[model samples]
Target: MSLENHAEFKLSITKALGDQLAAALKKLAPAPLAMENIRALRPLPGVYQLYKNGHLVYVGKADRSLPQRIEKHFRKISGRRNISLDQMAFTCLYVDEDFGAVAPERLLINEHRGQGQVPWNYNGFGNNDPGKRRDTTEVDEGHFDHDHPIDLEYRLTKLPSQCMEAGEALPLSQLLQETKTHLPYVFRYQASKEFDDIAVEFPDAETTADEALKTIAARLPDKWQITALPGYLIMYPKIEDYPSARRYYRSTGVVDVW
Candidate 1:
């Protein structure tokens, strides 16, 4: 059968079962799963299911209030075109503590799976087993080390007084151009006891650290003092060093320094 036809068939079965199903579900005191009524739900930990046209699509447990959790889901679907709040319904059972909701949620997911319901509980719903840890004793731990020697160049600039006073330092996300702004180099912003610091990054292969530093230096305003550090050194300056400053080569594989 076509996917659309299968969905229609399921919806038909749901409609046919509507009166009986509503009668049965009403015994559990299920709610209409609408925004206006969400605040009326009990603010306790619980397990909830999302039904699309009476067909179960998702099961979730809430460690907090069921109302808050359900409201979040409502907001998420509100912005989506494929899903609609009008076709969705929810039923929840309150539990005492956060942890108590887990087992019941797992049991429901397992029961649905065994019955071929297949609610979207993909990661083995509520499976808390941490899984075995791998033995890394024989593995050269050095291979995983990010500090492997690579030539690193850096540019250090003094923070403007307004930025220092307001503590409005740039975040790594902004420096990496994750925001709308783009910069020539990746840098980490730091606020120290002595002065505010920004450590520029030099990735391997593309541009030599020295060349990158010169380019950065040329672009920076004259009010800022620029300095170069010799090799890769992670900064952990003492509190007494307040403004202690040094630049170090950040290795190629280094993912995050913060």
Candidate 2:
């Protein structure tokens, strides 16, 4: 096996220490899967996701504590706990973590479920979709399973004037753009950290702490959406909802939405 595989193989031996693992594991955990271009902004608000293959397994919000949130997922991955996704690749995506507070994280969870992007839970959600009506047609777009990437230029803030006033059936792109601009500071903080890596730098402890809060404040608008989606990185919004969106996600036994 290659050196990386060998290391994980060696570490698996310590799995026997289940009872004492949590605490010890925390200190011994490896650094998170760092992102590319993670030095664009000051520490601020954002959302993050952990993906296996192109599918999302977990989503989280960072309210100025991007590193800490990222670390949480890394520690979970490193622990001896059972994890069995089809692909093991891991990468992170960030938006405004405020998305967490505004909407239910489960919304993102449901989005992925609707897309058939995430693997079915062990309870057999995947196999149980008998009618096949509940299944999402696998699309050709890459990472759509997790991030649902769209044209970045599609501005969400400048909603059609009449539609904005009436709150009519506005397009998803308009909604997103509005949300992004309404919370520019938040998105800026988010994009900055992922693209810039603010957490790894900054010498003053107080300054670092302040920047973290600024990030959180900047991202409040998007945090509402993250609250809806749960653990998905949110490349963008989905065009259609899954037929079994509610059933699959609601039945998955998720706890309170964060």
In TM-score terms, which candidate is top? 1
| Candidate 2 residue-wise lDDT, 1-258, digit = tens | 645544333553233322222233223323235432233324655544456654455544566666565544342233211343223333333445544454323444444465564443322221211223323433232222222211212222322322333323433333334344432112211232232221222112222212322333333333221211211112212223442121111111222221
Q: After superposition, how far is residue 258 of candidate 1 from its true place, in Å?
A: 35
User: lDDT value for candidate 1?
Assistant: 0.43
Scored against the true structure, residue 58 in model 1 reaches a CA lDDT of 66
Report lDDT (CA) for all predictions.
0.43, 0.32
lDDT of 2: 0.32
Q: State every prediction's TM-score relative to the real structure.
A: 0.38, 0.27
Across residues 77-120, which tens digit of lDDT does each residue of candidate 1 receive? Answer: 44333445788788876766745623556656655666556345
Q: What is the lDDT of residue 25 in candidate 1?
A: 39
Model 2 RMSD in angstroms: 20.2
Give me the displacement of residue 228 in model 2, in angstroms. 34
